[model samples]
Target: MPAKTKEQKTAACMALAMKRGDLKKTPGTPAGDMAESMTEEQLVELCGSKVKKGG
Candidate 1:
């Protein structure tokens, strides 16, 4: 899925942050939030678009 809004971005950010940390859970974080979930190809495309725009 694509992150089309700030809410989606925050959800994806939290999920990724949790994935990288050792904590089982984080307060105020939505455990069931998967609105921004995406496949590898989608991620690459999204980041690739940002990289181009940042240049």
Candidate 2:
């Protein structure tokens, strides 16, 4: 199932970001560059607010 909640959306986006190397791992932080600079639009684009039905 596609992500539906804010938490799920964020997790999905973070996973995608990691897979695409858009987000890096820092020694002390859970995320790197993308997290530090990511905008709301970027997150929404990465993980859509709603999943397309039967598509």
Candidate 3:
């Protein structure tokens, strides 16, 4: 499912970056853990289509 809040969408973006090796994954953190446990597709799904370039 898509993220329900901005925070959740942000987290998914961070996780996606980590999963794609674009960002360093800090183990034990929420986004890091999500990156470890979820697939790229899953992260993208959580990120949703409404994401924009800036806030």
Candidate 4:
């Protein structure tokens, strides 16, 4: 599912990174929780679009 908000996109990206071993996952945090619950493919689909520069 695509992210509906900037915060959601950011969280998905962070969670994806955690899943890929690029970032540390801290329990009880949003990104960490997402990392545990969602698959890497799911997180990627959520934030897969190229981010525009400077909003």
Kindly list the per-residue Cα lDDT of model 1 for residues 1-55, writing each as its tens digit: 3455555555555555455453354555552233234443543443333222221
**Residue-level lDDT tens digits of model 3 in 1-55:** 7566677788889999999989998999889988999999999988775544433
TM-score of each: 0.41, 0.42, 0.81, 0.83
- For candidate 4, the clash count comes to 0
Quote the positional error of residue 50 for candidate 2 in Å. Answer: 1.3
Pairs with steric clashes in candidate 1:
none
Worst 10 residues of 2 by lDDT: 25-34
Q: In model 1, where do residues sit more than 4 Å from their true spots? A: 22-55
Clash count, predicted structure 1: 0
Candidate 4 deviant stretches above 4 angstroms: 50-55
RMSD of each: 6.3, 8.2, 4.8, 4.0
| Model 1 lDDT, residue 4, Cα | 58
Q: What is candidate 2's lDDT per residue for 1-55, written digit by digit as tens?
A: 4545556566657745764667664533433444446564565565775654453
- Clash number for model 3? 0
- Candidates 2 and 3, the one with greater TM-score: 3
Clash numbers, per candidate: 0, 0, 0, 0
Best by TM-score: 4
Query: Residue 15 error for model 3, in Å?
Result: 0.3
Q: What lDDT would each prediction earn against the true structure?
A: 0.44, 0.56, 0.85, 0.85
Model 2 stretches with alpha carbons more than 4 Å out: 25-46, 49-55
